[model samples]
Structure formats: C-alpha cells, structure tokens
Target: MSAGRVAVAALFVVALVLFAAVEIASRREGSRVPSLGDVCGVVMRYRVGPLPVGRIAMFGFWWWLGWHFLAR
Candidate 1:
C-alpha cells in the first residue's frame, strides 16, 4: 500500500480507538463524560428563531457527506 493510504488507515484506526475509549468512559457509573447520544440530543434540542437549527444543520451535514462521498 502507498504511504498515504497507510497514514489514512492509521488515522482512522486511531479515531476508532479514541471513540471506543470515550464510549467506555461514558458508560462507567457516575461518569461525568457524556455519550454520543447525549451530545446529539443536546445538539438536536438547540433552536434558532423558531426553527430547529440543529436538526437542519445535521441534515445539511448528512446531505453534504452523502453528496461528496456516496454520490461519486
């Protein structure tokens, strides 16, 4: 494999490890760390001028992600 591909794969592995660590930490009893769902809930509860800005932003992000990555 090319060096660039190796680097990207290493980064992806590192991210997965970090995510797992955070999730495990959040699951501990009385842990102050928030899980992914808690963070998403907070984001989804945000609003702007009677509009659900957080949901809109999330949708936009998914759309953009799909357009750039999946629509190729």
Candidate 2:
C-alpha cells in the first residue's frame, strides 16, 4: 500500500479506537463521559431562526458521506 493510504487507514483505526474507548467509559458507573447519543441529542436541540440547524447539518454530513463513498 502507498504511504498515504497507510496513513489514512491508521488514522481511521485510531478514530475507531477512541470512539470505542469513549463509549465504554460513558457506560461505566459514576463516569462523566457522555455517550454518543447524548452528545448528538444536545447538538440536535439547537435551532437557528425557524430552521433546525443541527439536524440540517447532520443531514448534510450524511449526504456528503454517501455521495463521496457510495456514489458510482
């Protein structure tokens, strides 16, 4: 594999590890770390004027991801 691909894969692995660690920590008793759902809930609660900015932003993110990785 090329060095660039290797670097990107390593970064993706690190992100997954960090996410798993945080998720586990959030589940432990008396731990302060928030679960991913909690964070997303808080973010999605925000609004801009009449629009749900957080929700729109999330939709945009998912759309972008799908377009880039799933589209042929």
Query: Residue 3 in candidate 2 has what lDDT?
Result: 100
Cα lDDT computed for each candidate against the true fold:
0.94, 0.93
Candidate 1, which ten residues in sequence have the lowest lDDT sum?
A: 60-69
lDDT per residue (tens digit) for residues 1-72 in model 2: 899999999999999999999999999999999999999998888898999999998889889989987997
Question: Per-residue lDDT of 1-72 in model 1, one digit per residue for the tens?
Answer: 999989998998999999999999999999999998999899889998899999998899889989976998
The clash count for each model shown is: 0, 0
Error of 1 at 52 (Å): 1.1
Listed in order, each prediction's TM-score against the native is 0.83, 0.89
Worst 10 residues of 2 by lDDT: 42-51
After superposition, which runs of candidate 2 have C-alpha atoms over 4 Å from their true positions?
none
